[model samples]
Target: MKKKTFVLVVIALVSVGFSAMGQRVDRTNFKAGIHGGVPFGDISDHSNFELGLDVGYHIALSELIDTGLTTGFMNAFINNDSVDAGPVTVEGDFPNIQYVPVAAVFRLYPTYDFKLGADVGYAVGINDGNTGGGYLRPIIGVNVSGNTELNISYVKVSDDYDFSMAALGILFLF
Candidate 1:
Protein backbone atom coordinates (compact mmCIF):
# COMPACT_ATOMS: atom_id res chain seq x y z
CA MET A 1 0.00 0.00 0.00
CA LYS A 2 2.79 2.47 0.82
CA LYS A 3 4.62 1.53 -2.36
CA LYS A 4 1.50 2.30 -4.40
CA THR A 5 1.05 5.64 -2.64
CA PHE A 6 4.66 6.59 -3.31
CA VAL A 7 4.34 5.75 -7.02
CA LEU A 8 1.21 7.85 -7.36
CA VAL A 9 2.87 10.80 -5.64
CA VAL A 10 5.91 10.51 -7.86
CA ILE A 11 3.77 10.53 -11.00
CA ALA A 12 1.84 13.57 -9.81
CA LEU A 13 5.03 15.45 -9.05
CA VAL A 14 6.49 14.73 -12.50
CA SER A 15 3.34 15.89 -14.22
CA VAL A 16 3.28 19.08 -12.21
CA GLY A 17 6.92 19.75 -13.04
CA PHE A 18 6.36 19.33 -16.75
CA SER A 19 3.33 21.57 -16.68
CA ALA A 20 5.26 24.23 -14.85
CA MET A 21 8.04 24.06 -17.38
CA GLY A 22 5.54 24.72 -20.16
CA GLN A 23 4.31 27.92 -18.58
CA ARG A 24 5.82 31.08 -20.01
CA VAL A 25 4.51 34.49 -19.02
CA ASP A 26 6.44 36.54 -21.58
CA ARG A 27 4.93 35.34 -24.84
CA THR A 28 2.14 36.93 -26.78
CA ASN A 29 -1.05 34.88 -26.67
CA PHE A 30 -3.24 36.52 -29.30
CA LYS A 31 -2.85 38.24 -32.65
CA ALA A 32 -4.91 40.31 -35.10
CA GLY A 33 -4.16 41.64 -38.53
CA ILE A 34 -5.40 43.43 -41.62
CA HIS A 35 -4.32 42.88 -45.20
CA GLY A 36 -4.85 44.11 -48.74
CA GLY A 37 -3.71 43.01 -52.18
CA VAL A 38 -4.75 42.13 -55.69
CA PRO A 39 -6.47 39.03 -57.01
CA PHE A 40 -5.10 37.04 -59.92
CA GLY A 41 -6.15 34.30 -62.31
CA ASP A 42 -9.86 34.12 -63.26
CA ILE A 43 -10.95 36.23 -60.31
CA SER A 44 -8.97 39.19 -61.60
CA ASP A 45 -11.20 39.47 -64.60
CA HIS A 46 -14.11 40.29 -62.30
CA SER A 47 -12.46 41.98 -59.33
CA ASN A 48 -9.64 44.32 -58.54
CA PHE A 49 -8.10 44.53 -55.07
CA GLU A 50 -8.93 42.39 -52.05
CA LEU A 51 -9.02 43.41 -48.40
CA GLY A 52 -9.17 41.29 -45.24
CA LEU A 53 -8.92 41.09 -41.47
CA ASP A 54 -8.01 38.18 -39.20
CA VAL A 55 -7.65 37.23 -35.55
CA GLY A 56 -6.11 34.22 -33.85
CA TYR A 57 -4.93 32.65 -30.63
CA HIS A 58 -1.61 30.84 -30.67
CA ILE A 59 0.12 28.34 -28.44
CA ALA A 60 3.76 27.46 -28.65
CA LEU A 61 4.18 23.80 -29.52
CA SER A 62 7.96 23.97 -29.29
CA GLU A 63 10.75 26.50 -29.23
CA LEU A 64 10.54 26.91 -33.01
CA ILE A 65 6.92 25.97 -33.74
CA ASP A 66 3.50 27.38 -32.96
CA THR A 67 0.03 26.29 -33.93
CA GLY A 68 -3.32 27.99 -33.69
CA LEU A 69 -6.82 28.56 -34.98
CA THR A 70 -7.48 31.57 -37.17
CA THR A 71 -10.47 33.09 -38.89
CA GLY A 72 -10.89 36.08 -41.16
CA PHE A 73 -13.02 38.04 -43.55
CA MET A 74 -11.95 38.91 -47.07
CA ASN A 75 -13.70 40.79 -49.84
CA ALA A 76 -13.03 41.39 -53.51
CA PHE A 77 -14.67 44.30 -55.23
CA ILE A 78 -16.57 43.25 -58.33
CA ASN A 79 -16.33 45.29 -61.54
CA ASN A 80 -18.38 43.42 -64.08
CA ASP A 81 -20.71 45.13 -66.52
CA SER A 82 -23.51 42.63 -66.94
CA VAL A 83 -24.57 39.05 -66.38
CA ASP A 84 -26.41 36.72 -68.75
CA ALA A 85 -28.72 33.91 -67.72
CA GLY A 86 -30.47 31.34 -69.88
CA PRO A 87 -32.93 33.85 -71.34
CA VAL A 88 -32.54 36.99 -69.26
CA THR A 89 -29.65 39.42 -68.82
CA VAL A 90 -29.01 41.73 -65.86
CA GLU A 91 -27.09 44.91 -66.48
CA GLY A 92 -25.63 46.60 -63.45
CA ASP A 93 -22.68 46.60 -61.07
CA PHE A 94 -22.94 43.80 -58.52
CA PRO A 95 -22.05 43.43 -54.89
CA ASN A 96 -18.52 42.62 -53.71
CA ILE A 97 -17.62 38.95 -53.34
CA GLN A 98 -16.83 38.03 -49.76
CA TYR A 99 -15.28 35.05 -48.00
CA VAL A 100 -15.01 34.03 -44.39
CA PRO A 101 -12.01 31.80 -43.81
CA VAL A 102 -11.55 29.46 -40.89
CA ALA A 103 -8.26 27.62 -40.72
CA ALA A 104 -5.58 25.87 -38.72
CA VAL A 105 -2.31 27.72 -38.77
CA PHE A 106 1.15 26.27 -38.27
CA ARG A 107 4.12 28.56 -37.98
CA LEU A 108 7.85 27.81 -37.93
CA TYR A 109 10.00 30.48 -36.41
CA PRO A 110 13.59 30.28 -37.63
CA THR A 111 14.56 33.38 -35.66
CA TYR A 112 13.03 35.83 -33.23
CA ASP A 113 12.03 38.07 -36.12
CA PHE A 114 11.42 35.73 -39.03
CA LYS A 115 8.80 33.06 -39.48
CA LEU A 116 7.14 30.92 -42.10
CA GLY A 117 3.65 29.57 -41.86
CA ALA A 118 0.77 27.91 -43.64
CA ASP A 119 -2.99 28.16 -43.17
CA VAL A 120 -5.16 25.34 -44.39
CA GLY A 121 -8.91 25.04 -44.16
CA TYR A 122 -12.03 26.35 -45.84
CA ALA A 123 -13.48 29.64 -47.00
CA VAL A 124 -17.22 30.17 -46.90
CA GLY A 125 -18.81 32.44 -49.43
CA ILE A 126 -21.28 35.15 -48.44
CA ASN A 127 -23.14 35.57 -51.69
CA ASP A 128 -26.19 34.01 -53.21
CA GLY A 129 -25.68 30.95 -55.38
CA ASN A 130 -22.02 30.77 -54.33
CA THR A 131 -20.65 27.67 -52.70
CA GLY A 132 -17.79 27.64 -50.21
CA GLY A 133 -14.49 25.86 -50.79
CA GLY A 134 -11.14 24.75 -49.42
CA TYR A 135 -8.37 27.27 -48.98
CA LEU A 136 -4.56 27.28 -48.65
CA ARG A 137 -2.32 30.18 -47.76
CA PRO A 138 1.44 30.07 -47.40
CA ILE A 139 3.07 33.02 -45.70
CA ILE A 140 6.39 34.54 -44.71
CA GLY A 141 6.58 37.05 -41.88
CA VAL A 142 9.02 39.44 -40.27
CA ASN A 143 8.65 41.07 -36.89
CA VAL A 144 9.10 44.74 -37.59
CA SER A 145 8.53 45.93 -34.03
CA GLY A 146 8.06 44.48 -30.59
CA ASN A 147 4.39 43.69 -31.11
CA THR A 148 3.96 44.23 -34.84
CA GLU A 149 4.72 41.83 -37.66
CA LEU A 150 4.65 42.26 -41.42
CA ASN A 151 3.79 39.34 -43.65
CA ILE A 152 3.25 38.50 -47.28
CA SER A 153 1.18 35.53 -48.35
CA TYR A 154 -0.37 33.78 -51.30
CA VAL A 155 -3.98 32.65 -50.85
CA LYS A 156 -5.66 30.03 -52.99
CA VAL A 157 -9.26 28.95 -52.93
CA SER A 158 -10.49 25.84 -54.66
CA ASP A 159 -14.17 25.86 -55.51
CA ASP A 160 -16.13 25.31 -58.68
CA TYR A 161 -13.68 27.91 -59.94
CA ASP A 162 -10.23 28.54 -58.45
CA PHE A 163 -8.99 31.94 -57.39
CA SER A 164 -5.75 33.28 -55.92
CA MET A 165 -4.35 36.44 -54.42
CA ALA A 166 -1.06 37.93 -53.20
CA ALA A 167 -1.40 39.91 -49.98
CA LEU A 168 0.73 42.03 -47.64
CA GLY A 169 -0.36 42.49 -44.07
CA ILE A 170 0.56 43.57 -40.56
CA LEU A 171 -0.19 41.68 -37.39
CA PHE A 172 -0.36 43.02 -33.86
CA LEU A 173 0.33 40.56 -31.07
CA PHE A 174 -0.87 40.79 -27.53
Candidate 2:
Protein backbone atom coordinates (compact mmCIF):
# COMPACT_ATOMS: atom_id res chain seq x y z
CA MET A 1 0.00 0.00 0.00
CA LYS A 2 1.06 3.64 -0.42
CA LYS A 3 0.97 4.21 3.32
CA LYS A 4 3.39 1.37 3.92
CA THR A 5 5.78 2.69 1.31
CA PHE A 6 5.68 6.17 2.81
CA VAL A 7 6.44 4.80 6.27
CA LEU A 8 9.37 2.78 4.96
CA VAL A 9 10.78 5.83 3.24
CA VAL A 10 10.50 7.88 6.38
CA ILE A 11 12.26 5.21 8.44
CA ALA A 12 15.09 5.02 5.94
CA LEU A 13 15.54 8.77 6.07
CA VAL A 14 15.72 8.75 9.86
CA SER A 15 18.35 6.00 9.79
CA VAL A 16 20.47 8.03 7.38
CA GLY A 17 20.11 11.07 9.60
CA PHE A 18 21.42 9.16 12.60
CA SER A 19 24.40 7.99 10.58
CA ALA A 20 25.21 11.59 9.76
CA MET A 21 25.00 12.65 13.32
CA GLY A 22 27.88 11.31 15.50
CA GLN A 23 26.98 7.68 14.99
CA ARG A 24 29.79 5.27 14.44
CA VAL A 25 30.35 4.33 10.88
CA ASP A 26 32.58 1.57 9.60
CA ARG A 27 35.82 3.47 9.90
CA THR A 28 38.78 4.09 12.12
CA ASN A 29 38.85 6.73 14.81
CA PHE A 30 41.66 7.78 17.11
CA LYS A 31 41.63 9.32 20.55
CA ALA A 32 44.03 10.72 23.09
CA GLY A 33 43.63 11.49 26.77
CA ILE A 34 45.12 12.09 30.19
CA HIS A 35 43.92 10.26 33.29
CA GLY A 36 44.86 10.45 36.94
CA GLY A 37 43.74 8.88 40.19
CA VAL A 38 44.71 7.16 43.42
CA PRO A 39 46.22 3.75 43.75
CA PHE A 40 44.56 1.15 45.97
CA GLY A 41 45.40 -2.06 47.88
CA ASP A 42 49.06 -3.01 48.15
CA ILE A 43 50.39 -0.34 45.84
CA SER A 44 48.78 2.40 47.90
CA ASP A 45 51.24 1.81 50.66
CA HIS A 46 54.00 3.21 48.46
CA SER A 47 52.35 5.62 46.05
CA ASN A 48 49.78 8.35 46.14
CA PHE A 49 48.03 9.16 42.89
CA GLU A 50 48.87 7.79 39.47
CA LEU A 51 48.81 9.92 36.32
CA GLY A 52 48.85 8.77 32.74
CA LEU A 53 48.51 9.78 29.10
CA ASP A 54 47.05 7.44 26.53
CA VAL A 55 46.26 7.08 22.85
CA GLY A 56 43.96 4.67 21.08
CA TYR A 57 42.93 3.64 17.57
CA HIS A 58 39.46 2.15 17.17
CA ILE A 59 37.79 0.51 14.23
CA ALA A 60 34.04 0.61 14.14
CA LEU A 61 32.58 -2.82 13.68
CA SER A 62 29.00 -1.61 13.63
CA GLU A 63 26.82 1.30 14.63
CA LEU A 64 27.11 0.32 18.29
CA ILE A 65 30.46 -1.39 18.66
CA ASP A 66 34.13 -0.54 18.30
CA THR A 67 37.30 -2.52 18.82
CA GLY A 68 40.72 -1.00 19.20
CA LEU A 69 44.21 -0.97 20.56
CA THR A 70 45.38 1.46 23.22
CA THR A 71 48.74 2.34 24.66
CA GLY A 72 49.75 4.70 27.43
CA PHE A 73 52.18 5.89 30.02
CA MET A 74 51.25 5.51 33.68
CA ASN A 75 53.30 6.85 36.57
CA ALA A 76 52.56 6.29 40.23
CA PHE A 77 54.06 9.00 42.34
CA ILE A 78 56.14 7.82 45.22
CA ASN A 79 55.27 8.68 48.78
CA ASN A 80 57.60 9.53 51.64
CA ASP A 81 58.48 6.39 53.53
CA SER A 82 58.65 7.97 56.94
CA VAL A 83 55.66 6.96 59.02
CA ASP A 84 55.24 8.99 62.17
CA ALA A 85 52.34 7.70 64.24
CA GLY A 86 52.14 9.35 67.66
CA PRO A 87 55.36 8.28 69.45
CA VAL A 88 56.13 5.49 66.96
CA THR A 89 58.25 6.44 63.99
CA VAL A 90 59.56 4.52 60.99
CA GLU A 91 61.52 5.47 57.87
CA GLY A 92 62.25 3.77 54.55
CA ASP A 93 62.32 4.42 50.80
CA PHE A 94 59.59 4.00 48.18
CA PRO A 95 60.29 5.05 44.61
CA ASN A 96 57.85 5.94 41.89
CA ILE A 97 56.44 3.05 39.90
CA GLN A 98 56.09 3.46 36.14
CA TYR A 99 54.44 1.30 33.50
CA VAL A 100 53.48 1.29 29.84
CA PRO A 101 50.25 -0.49 29.06
CA VAL A 102 49.47 -1.95 25.66
CA ALA A 103 45.89 -3.13 25.53
CA ALA A 104 43.11 -4.23 23.24
CA VAL A 105 39.89 -2.36 23.85
CA PHE A 106 36.31 -3.38 23.14
CA ARG A 107 33.62 -0.75 23.55
CA LEU A 108 29.88 -1.00 23.30
CA TYR A 109 27.70 2.04 22.85
CA PRO A 110 24.33 1.58 24.47
CA THR A 111 23.14 4.89 23.14
CA TYR A 112 24.62 7.82 21.28
CA ASP A 113 25.74 9.38 24.52
CA PHE A 114 26.94 6.44 26.65
CA LYS A 115 29.51 3.68 26.36
CA LEU A 116 31.15 0.84 28.29
CA GLY A 117 34.37 -0.92 27.47
CA ALA A 118 37.16 -3.15 28.66
CA ASP A 119 40.86 -2.99 27.94
CA VAL A 120 43.10 -5.99 28.49
CA GLY A 121 46.75 -6.56 27.78
CA TYR A 122 50.18 -6.55 29.34
CA ALA A 123 51.87 -3.69 31.12
CA VAL A 124 55.59 -3.29 30.63
CA GLY A 125 57.46 -2.13 33.68
CA ILE A 126 59.74 0.87 33.33
CA ASN A 127 61.25 1.61 36.74
CA ASP A 128 61.29 1.07 40.51
CA GLY A 129 61.81 -2.66 40.60
CA ASN A 130 58.59 -3.29 38.75
CA THR A 131 58.57 -6.39 36.60
CA GLY A 132 55.26 -5.97 34.84
CA GLY A 133 52.46 -8.45 34.34
CA GLY A 134 48.86 -8.25 33.14
CA TYR A 135 46.83 -5.13 32.58
CA LEU A 136 43.03 -4.91 32.73
CA ARG A 137 40.80 -1.87 32.79
CA PRO A 138 37.06 -1.61 32.69
CA ILE A 139 35.57 1.73 31.76
CA ILE A 140 32.36 3.66 31.37
CA GLY A 141 32.04 6.94 29.54
CA VAL A 142 29.69 9.59 28.34
CA ASN A 143 30.03 11.40 25.04
CA VAL A 144 29.75 15.05 25.93
CA SER A 145 30.32 16.49 22.47
CA GLY A 146 30.89 15.35 18.93
CA ASN A 147 34.58 14.82 19.55
CA THR A 148 34.92 14.65 23.31
CA GLU A 149 34.08 12.19 26.08
CA LEU A 150 34.44 11.87 29.84
CA ASN A 151 35.27 8.50 31.33
CA ILE A 152 36.04 6.61 34.52
CA SER A 153 37.98 3.41 34.75
CA TYR A 154 39.38 0.95 37.26
CA VAL A 155 42.88 -0.08 36.29
CA LYS A 156 44.67 -3.15 37.63
CA VAL A 157 48.25 -3.97 36.84
CA SER A 158 50.49 -6.49 38.46
CA ASP A 159 54.17 -6.47 39.26
CA ASP A 160 55.49 -7.72 42.57
CA TYR A 161 52.09 -6.62 43.80
CA ASP A 162 48.78 -5.58 42.33
CA PHE A 163 49.19 -1.96 41.37
CA SER A 164 45.59 -0.96 41.02
CA MET A 165 44.00 2.46 40.67
CA ALA A 166 40.75 4.19 39.90
CA ALA A 167 40.99 6.98 37.34
CA LEU A 168 38.92 9.67 35.68
CA GLY A 169 39.74 11.18 32.32
CA ILE A 170 38.58 13.19 29.33
CA LEU A 171 39.20 11.97 25.83
CA PHE A 172 39.29 13.78 22.51
CA LEU A 173 38.46 11.71 19.47
CA PHE A 174 39.48 12.28 15.85
Candidate 3:
Protein backbone atom coordinates (compact mmCIF):
# COMPACT_ATOMS: atom_id res chain seq x y z
CA MET A 1 0.00 0.00 0.00
CA LYS A 2 2.74 2.46 0.92
CA LYS A 3 4.77 1.62 -2.14
CA LYS A 4 1.79 2.21 -4.41
CA THR A 5 1.11 5.59 -2.83
CA PHE A 6 4.74 6.58 -3.21
CA VAL A 7 4.76 5.65 -6.90
CA LEU A 8 1.61 7.66 -7.56
CA VAL A 9 3.08 10.74 -5.93
CA VAL A 10 6.24 10.48 -8.00
CA ILE A 11 4.21 10.12 -11.17
CA ALA A 12 2.02 13.11 -10.37
CA LEU A 13 4.99 15.32 -9.63
CA VAL A 14 6.71 14.26 -12.81
CA SER A 15 3.62 15.02 -14.87
CA VAL A 16 3.35 18.46 -13.33
CA GLY A 17 6.97 19.17 -14.12
CA PHE A 18 6.56 18.04 -17.69
CA SER A 19 3.43 20.13 -18.23
CA ALA A 20 5.24 23.18 -16.97
CA MET A 21 8.12 22.73 -19.31
CA GLY A 22 6.68 24.90 -22.08
CA GLN A 23 5.83 27.86 -19.92
CA ARG A 24 8.17 30.80 -19.78
CA VAL A 25 8.95 31.28 -16.12
CA ASP A 26 11.14 33.08 -13.71
CA ARG A 27 13.74 30.66 -12.43
CA THR A 28 13.96 27.23 -10.88
CA ASN A 29 15.79 26.71 -7.65
CA PHE A 30 17.73 23.75 -6.29
CA LYS A 31 18.37 23.66 -2.61
CA ALA A 32 20.10 21.43 -0.07
CA GLY A 33 20.33 21.65 3.69
CA ILE A 34 20.93 19.99 7.04
CA HIS A 35 18.66 20.22 10.05
CA GLY A 36 18.61 19.27 13.72
CA GLY A 37 15.72 19.07 16.15
CA VAL A 38 14.23 17.37 19.17
CA PRO A 39 11.79 14.51 18.91
CA PHE A 40 8.41 14.53 20.58
CA GLY A 41 5.56 12.16 21.47
CA ASP A 42 6.20 8.43 21.41
CA ILE A 43 9.52 9.06 19.71
CA SER A 44 10.72 11.17 22.63
CA ASP A 45 10.35 8.22 24.92
CA HIS A 46 13.20 6.54 23.12
CA SER A 47 15.04 9.24 21.23
CA ASN A 48 16.91 12.34 22.31
CA PHE A 49 17.60 14.26 19.09
CA GLU A 50 17.01 14.13 15.36
CA LEU A 51 19.28 15.13 12.53
CA GLY A 52 18.55 15.19 8.81
CA LEU A 53 19.58 16.24 5.35
CA ASP A 54 17.29 17.49 2.59
CA VAL A 55 17.43 18.35 -1.09
CA GLY A 56 14.70 19.97 -3.16
CA TYR A 57 13.92 21.43 -6.57
CA HIS A 58 11.43 24.23 -6.86
CA ILE A 59 9.94 25.72 -10.01
CA ALA A 60 8.06 28.99 -10.08
CA LEU A 61 4.34 28.48 -10.70
CA SER A 62 3.51 32.15 -10.37
CA GLU A 63 4.76 35.24 -8.63
CA LEU A 64 3.46 33.92 -5.36
CA ILE A 65 3.50 30.14 -5.73
CA ASP A 66 6.08 27.47 -6.27
CA THR A 67 5.78 23.70 -6.45
CA GLY A 68 8.53 21.17 -6.14
CA LEU A 69 9.82 17.79 -5.07
CA THR A 70 11.73 17.20 -1.87
CA THR A 71 13.40 14.20 -0.33
CA GLY A 72 15.57 13.67 2.70
CA PHE A 73 16.99 11.46 5.36
CA MET A 74 16.11 11.91 9.03
CA ASN A 75 17.38 9.94 12.01
CA ALA A 76 16.27 9.96 15.61
CA PHE A 77 18.99 8.82 17.92
CA ILE A 78 17.94 6.30 20.51
CA ASN A 79 18.36 6.80 24.25
CA ASN A 80 17.54 3.52 25.96
CA ASP A 81 20.14 0.96 26.98
CA SER A 82 17.86 -1.89 26.02
CA VAL A 83 14.50 -2.66 24.47
CA ASP A 84 11.78 -5.09 25.51
CA ALA A 85 10.05 -7.14 22.86
CA GLY A 86 7.15 -9.18 24.20
CA PRO A 87 8.57 -11.40 26.96
CA VAL A 88 12.12 -10.99 25.75
CA THR A 89 14.46 -8.20 26.78
CA VAL A 90 17.27 -7.32 24.39
CA GLU A 91 20.36 -5.67 25.81
CA GLY A 92 22.99 -3.33 24.48
CA ASP A 93 22.58 -0.27 22.23
CA PHE A 94 20.31 -0.14 19.19
CA PRO A 95 20.58 1.76 15.96
CA ASN A 96 18.96 5.12 15.48
CA ILE A 97 15.46 5.22 14.01
CA GLN A 98 15.76 6.52 10.47
CA TYR A 99 13.40 7.74 7.78
CA VAL A 100 13.61 8.66 4.14
CA PRO A 101 10.95 11.18 3.21
CA VAL A 102 9.85 11.77 -0.36
CA ALA A 103 7.27 14.44 -0.85
CA ALA A 104 5.60 17.10 -2.95
CA VAL A 105 6.48 20.58 -1.73
CA PHE A 106 4.45 23.72 -2.12
CA ARG A 107 5.54 27.21 -1.26
CA LEU A 108 3.75 30.53 -1.08
CA TYR A 109 6.09 33.44 -1.33
CA PRO A 110 4.46 36.60 -0.01
CA THR A 111 7.65 38.45 -0.76
CA TYR A 112 10.91 37.70 -2.45
CA ASP A 113 12.53 37.36 0.94
CA PHE A 114 9.89 35.46 2.85
CA LYS A 115 8.01 32.23 2.18
CA LEU A 116 5.68 29.75 3.78
CA GLY A 117 5.57 26.15 2.64
CA ALA A 118 4.46 22.64 3.32
CA ASP A 119 5.76 19.20 2.46
CA VAL A 120 3.36 16.27 2.40
CA GLY A 121 4.66 12.77 1.79
CA TYR A 122 5.62 9.34 3.01
CA ALA A 123 8.57 8.56 5.25
CA VAL A 124 10.08 5.10 4.85
CA GLY A 125 11.89 3.48 7.69
CA ILE A 126 15.42 2.20 7.29
CA ASN A 127 15.83 0.05 10.38
CA ASP A 128 13.55 -1.87 12.70
CA GLY A 129 10.61 -0.26 10.87
CA ASN A 130 9.85 1.98 13.81
CA THR A 131 9.34 5.23 11.93
CA GLY A 132 7.69 4.56 8.59
CA GLY A 133 4.78 6.96 8.30
CA GLY A 134 3.03 9.70 6.40
CA TYR A 135 4.56 13.10 7.14
CA LEU A 136 3.45 16.69 6.91
CA ARG A 137 5.79 19.56 7.50
CA PRO A 138 4.88 23.23 7.69
CA ILE A 139 7.73 25.62 7.26
CA ILE A 140 8.51 29.31 7.50
CA GLY A 141 11.50 30.70 5.69
CA VAL A 142 13.49 33.88 5.31
CA ASN A 143 16.15 34.85 2.85
CA VAL A 144 19.07 35.82 5.06
CA SER A 145 21.35 36.64 2.14
CA GLY A 146 21.50 36.17 -1.61
CA ASN A 147 20.81 32.52 -2.35
CA THR A 148 20.89 31.65 1.33
CA GLU A 149 17.72 30.81 3.22
CA LEU A 150 17.00 30.03 6.85
CA ASN A 151 13.93 28.04 7.79
CA ILE A 152 12.10 26.69 10.77
CA SER A 153 9.61 23.83 10.43
CA TYR A 154 7.32 21.60 12.41
CA VAL A 155 7.17 18.02 11.19
CA LYS A 156 4.51 15.49 12.10
CA VAL A 157 4.69 11.83 11.14
CA SER A 158 1.64 9.65 11.59
CA ASP A 159 1.80 5.90 11.88
CA ASP A 160 1.08 3.32 14.55
CA TYR A 161 3.04 5.69 16.75
CA ASP A 162 2.81 9.37 15.90
CA PHE A 163 5.73 11.72 16.42
CA SER A 164 6.80 15.27 15.73
CA MET A 165 9.81 17.53 15.60
CA ALA A 166 10.71 21.19 15.50
CA ALA A 167 13.57 21.81 13.10
CA LEU A 168 15.80 24.73 12.20
CA GLY A 169 17.91 24.67 9.08
CA ILE A 170 19.69 26.72 6.44
CA LEU A 171 19.45 26.03 2.72
CA PHE A 172 21.75 27.08 -0.04
CA LEU A 173 19.92 27.79 -3.29
CA PHE A 174 21.34 27.54 -6.76
Q: Write the per-residue lDDT of candidate 2 for residues 1-174, one digit (tens) a residue.
A: 643564465345334433543445557788999999899988787688899998987778787887767889999997877755459877877567889987777789999899999877778888866778777899999999999999999998855677899999999998
Clashing pairs in 2: none
Error of 1 at 43 (Å): 0.4
Tell me which residue pairs clash in candidate 3: none
Per-residue CA lDDT of candidate 3, range 1-174, in tens?
A: 875786687568656754664363577889999999888887787787999998998888888988878898998888888876569988986888888888888899999999999988777878875757777899999999999999999988776775798999989998
Better of 1 and 2 by TM-score: 1
lDDT of 1 by residue, 1-174 (tens): 643564465345444433533665345358999999799987887788999998876667678877666788999888777655449888886777788987777789999899999887778888765676777899999999999999999999876666799999999998
Candidate 1 stretches greater than 4 Å from native = 1-28, 83-90
Query: What TM-score do all the candidates reach, one by one?
Result: 0.79, 0.78, 0.84
Rate residue 174 of model 3 by lDDT.
Answer: 82
Off by over 4 Å in 2: 1-25, 82-93
Q: Candidate 1's C-alpha lDDT?
A: 0.79
Of candidate 2, the 10-residue stretch with the lowest lDDT total is 13-22
